[model samples]
Target: MSNRAKLFGALSLGACLLWFRAAAEVPPETVGQVAELPPMAGAHWLWVPDRLFRHSILFDGDSGRMLGAIDSGVQITPKPPLWSHARKEIYNVDTIYSRGHRGERKDFVVIYDSRTLNVKGEVEVPPRAADTGTGIALVGLLDGDRFLVVLNQSPGTSVSVIDLENRRHVGEAQTAGCAGVFPAGPTRFGMLCGDGTALTVHLTENGELDRLARSKPFFDVIDDPVTEKGVRDGSTWWFASFEGLLYEVDFSGNAPAPKEPWPLFTENEIESGWRIGGAQHLAYHRKTKRLYSIVHEGGPGSHKDPGTEIWVYDVPSRNKIDTFSAPNLIAPFLGPQAGFDATGMLGSFLSFVLPNMGVHSLTVTQDERPLLFVRHSDLGAVGVLDALSGEHLRDIDEAGLSGALLVVP
Candidate 1:
């Protein structure tokens, strides 16, 4: 063959080979569309609110995929969204400035369609709502989701009532020294006061204040205060004190009924310095009646310290069952199997190193097969574990740092 023909043939072959190589290396087509990750992901969705970012990010708990987020707003304390499966909507009370950080202030409650994740409607509220963060207790629903209760604070504590069915502000109730709005019954809600007592505010069907009832002082407000984090089972709200004591208060009656208080740990565990600690420490599963808490070995003034492990308790039996690890920075260095042993030599070394490596907030999904979702606040990462086994299954790295954990299910 001629030299020119041979050269042309070689060049053509090289071009074809390059094209095939490029085709093999190319990634799959990117789809810009949004689709649900798993079947009924909303049932097990994890809603994490980052107060610094002024928003809440939603994740498919089954697959740990980032679904979306809600822009809550800035300069105001974080307001966790209220999730209603029956209504197929998530309600968020937000106070947004006209500018990114400052300008005109507008306070309103927004309803988002859970399926479409879009704003359905909103109701303008008075500008006096509280700017202090209160986790999930800041917002509440009553009367089978007919009325919405929003706590207010401009130095004094009060609550603004909103008629959800009519989408209008109804009235305001003076709660005085009480902080959160805990729905007591069909019309009223309970609040923990500065004096360590509970005040139940009853409302008429039209959302008007009918009367007020108070409970006898049950906890010591100064010594061992009950954290604001409370989980309700039926008409009873379970609270844990800083010293690891449990309070079971029945709000079903006309007034709050405090049950016999008990300590979560035995004398030995107490001696080991085991106490509940974390931004959020209690996560209760209604079916199993199991309350999971973040526990750590620390002295006084460490109530807000990160937890080294999780301890599970059965509410009815009032007995400890399972315990799991939530190790800190050095735990990974000792290998994957090494847990945070607060009493051991390595654990003592970790205390001197980065003692803050542990779970910060936790929430458990209510389902036949339950899963515990824990957040490491300092790192803003999430750990998923089997509720029954306390086995660490996986971690969701995309969750934003420094936020409270909320599960829609």
Candidate 2:
């Protein structure tokens, strides 16, 4: 192998070793009992993360009806901070979203209630969460209880597991450079690292990081025709579908190289399709293994009109299935207090479609209802989409966004 390749390999090994040492020293936190929210017999809640301000938690009535917005009193100030992954406990706090400001995290996590929509509690992220120069942190819950947060650290990135049961910071794993994180199985997770590599890591005894198969980037060529025209920002802005591209690796750790790379979507030639002028919300379907993204029709900032498009891809087959468009989308006009007029004024704005860019966040209901959450480039409006049938649900007014999605078991 070339000298550079050998050096890169050594660096990855050293980083992993340092992380393992840290994990061993950090004992698990004592998870306090989860407080339950007051009974809301027929209400369901979803989270919205804004870029400029605080995250917003919204409530929907039974059968997917629009109930109204939940007041998450926390306001994440500053112009370019992040409030990511809003989630609620089963019946207690309405939701919690991850927040960090100016690259420094003020709170590891924040919580909210369902009935009154008030701030409930806060938790500290594992020591690994405060890494600097990392962009686009993704958080997830594993086996229904444990919390996992992954992000790229300057010069590298790592994954940390929070012992929610004990309510304390716990295990962590240094990973390949990453931009996104996904649950591959019960104890296994997948990440597309920042260095253009995709890897799957399995949790061993005590949350140790086990080497899994990795994949090299197959579609690495930049489409100059589009990018040169000032299109395609390339900032974690692409989506994958059920059969778009699947790279299966043998991560048993018994093979020659535990950190090898492969591609899962090689059989079909998957290409970028429609573009939502200023779109930025993404959703994935587990059963169908399909990926969908939402884009706004107009330019960023102003919400004159917003549109929706659903791109279906099969990950295993690496193919594009179909596309649908919804010209009408609802825009929410938000106010400062609980007495704000949020009724009847739900769906107001419209969005256009932009191709290739992945979504910021997305989710599908049990009944196959695909809900995509998107923000206007420059406005404080949010868009919800029904991807399966291309139905524009409603748009709610929110500010300073990062990521948004629904809570699923």
Candidate 3:
């Protein structure tokens, strides 16, 4: 060999000798060891679905700490996780490809053990629920948590009912112009349509659709459209419109009963250009019978905009009782809630460069002492607030990207 080749060969041999020596010095680590999570409180756990990463992250609302997360599916569109306090389980409807991302697609429901957060079982369903966003109304539990109702919209619109006990798709209710799955009874659900009507579907005990009923159009579809993020109060469902109108529909009887619509904003508030927005996650406390919605100072056609404030209303009385400004969930490195603003390079970058997002989703616990959870979608942070007083309690950062919905158990 030449002189240059000999020099390189010696260097390579010396580097290999040093690597072997270092590897021999370090001990091997143990593997195949699994760990179980501790017991969690019923009302303290919050499920935040990260649509971008396609996973559902669990956080403790009391301490604002991330407990764990479960994968929703291999697909891009994510369905919000459903929690069953009765069965002590969590359910996620998903769609995955047979050969990674480009093969025969399989839509299914994944059951997870609430305590261990492990995969318990899975039920195969039709590929009907893969096109929906992470909306609270896209999925729900029926028949005492035995059946899972999934709203579908992929070129065609329908609701797929999955029998979790039998691990199969039970039935499909054709809701062509309708969207959302609001559980009205143990075996029935209501869906809001695009033509200003609602459909109530009653299912058999075997999880098959028995009959369907349609209610008269109560809200206008052309002028002011009611949002699909409707909240439930026993058998009554309250929906907010783009122009700050609350429409109530009762399903206590065999058919849906429509009640007169009420204005959520007063004369002065409407004049100042205030309307309801944030159609993904609206909070409703069962015990208090109050509905929480994100409100902002925007004119018409801005129903999907993010809101910097939250307004609470008494559903029974049809009156606005409380309104609170959304707190800054993201803490800047050197700005208003942290340091100076527009003073130096760091200050200017923190204040103007970075965007302080607003609340795009909301949820509240059902316990006696309730707490509200608000999500900043772009920031992937959550702000905890007192449900009764509307006071900012704490903020949780690094939650997850594209957290579209929040669920409390």
Candidate 4:
């Protein structure tokens, strides 16, 4: 063969190899598009993904079937989706950036119909800072779902109140050094400050900040800071500290009144290094009046570690009623070893190498047969457990569901 012909053949072979390598790197497409499932009866579970994708998924609480999803588009951070039973609507707050300018950004609250999942309306507000570190209640509905409150943090912290009925931005409230929005009353909400106090903001019927009040120091800000993710039981808000102390605050009145703090762990348990930890560590069941917490054994700085056991408590009696192991404890390290010694050894090694799985968020179904929804961040699995009997019902595998906020409606 000629020298030029030999060189041409070598180039063609090189090109083929490059094409094969590129094809191998490409991810396989999903089998089919996610079809919109009909909304089933009973409470629906909505979870917001922390990473990988910018969308919230709605699943049937009873059947563990995915009903639909609210896609937030690419590279956008969304607040926890809010569901209004009265109006049958889903509200999402997210930030949008300009095409040319990096600094040009706007925050928008988009409304969606619950049944069809169609875009109903959208209102633009000031841009908000994206803080994914702490689990904060950044969005809330107030005044019978007529007004929507959103927390904003461009460089400083504040809140924007939007009139949902009119689809307009009403006003903004300054909440410096404080974070998160916890609904206090029909026209009021509270924000946890860095000074160990909660600042309450009262809004008018038009969604303007009417007045503001700050509670006295309740927890130690320097020593053990309380998480912003508080579980609301009626007008009472229960906040958990890093060291496993439960602080109760009554927001039923004009101001947020702090109650006495209670030890979540016994003396022996404290000595055994039990502490409140995880992405979302506390859940409250109103009907049962029980507070469920994800706990783990850790040192002083391990308050953010994953949990291994769930401790149930009766808040009224201030008694520990029951304790159960998390489903992660019994989850198979490897599926179907089937007499394969290598597979069995690999499973054992994985069980030892991986951290103990724990509950990131917990929620109870609103219907009669209350099922506890537990999000295990380590395994990326959501387990449905019987709330009363502590039985593991089933597990739903979803990628990037870790550190997700679980909302039921």
Candidate 1, RMSD to the unseen true structure = 13.3
TM-score of each: 0.83, 0.54, 0.84, 0.83
Model 3 misplacement above 4 A:
1-41, 75-77, 332-356
Model 1 agreement with the true structure over 51-144: per-residue lDDT tens digits = 6777888887777778888888663435777776557777888887788667877889999887777899999987767765436577788758
For each candidate in the order shown, give its overall lDDT on alpha carbons. 0.75, 0.39, 0.75, 0.71
- In model 2, how many backbone clashes occur? 79
Model 2, position 222, has a per-residue lDDT of: 33
Shift of residue 96 alpha carbon in model 4, Å: 1.9
Decreasing TM-score order of the candidates = 3, 1, 4, 2
Give the 10-residue window scoring lowest on summed lDDT in candidate 2: 224-233
**Model 1 global lDDT (CA atoms, 0 to 1):** 0.75
Q: For candidate 3, what is the lDDT?
A: 0.75
Put down candidate 3 lDDT per residue, 1-409, tens digits, no spaces.
3323533443353354445542223368898866655555457678877878888788888886778888977655466777766667788888888788778888888998877888899887777573645456778887488888988878678899888777788878887888888888888888888889888988898888898888988889988888878877778888888787888898767778888888988999999998777646477898888888888777777776678788888877888898887865444211222322324564444334334445778888888888888876655667889999998787665677565677775
Residue-wise lDDT of candidate 2 within 176-295, one digit each (tens)? 555345554446665654444456667764455666656665333232111100101111123322222222333223221212223222332224322332222344565566655443
* Candidate 2 TM-score, true structure as reference: 0.54
Identify the leading candidate in terms of TM-score. 3
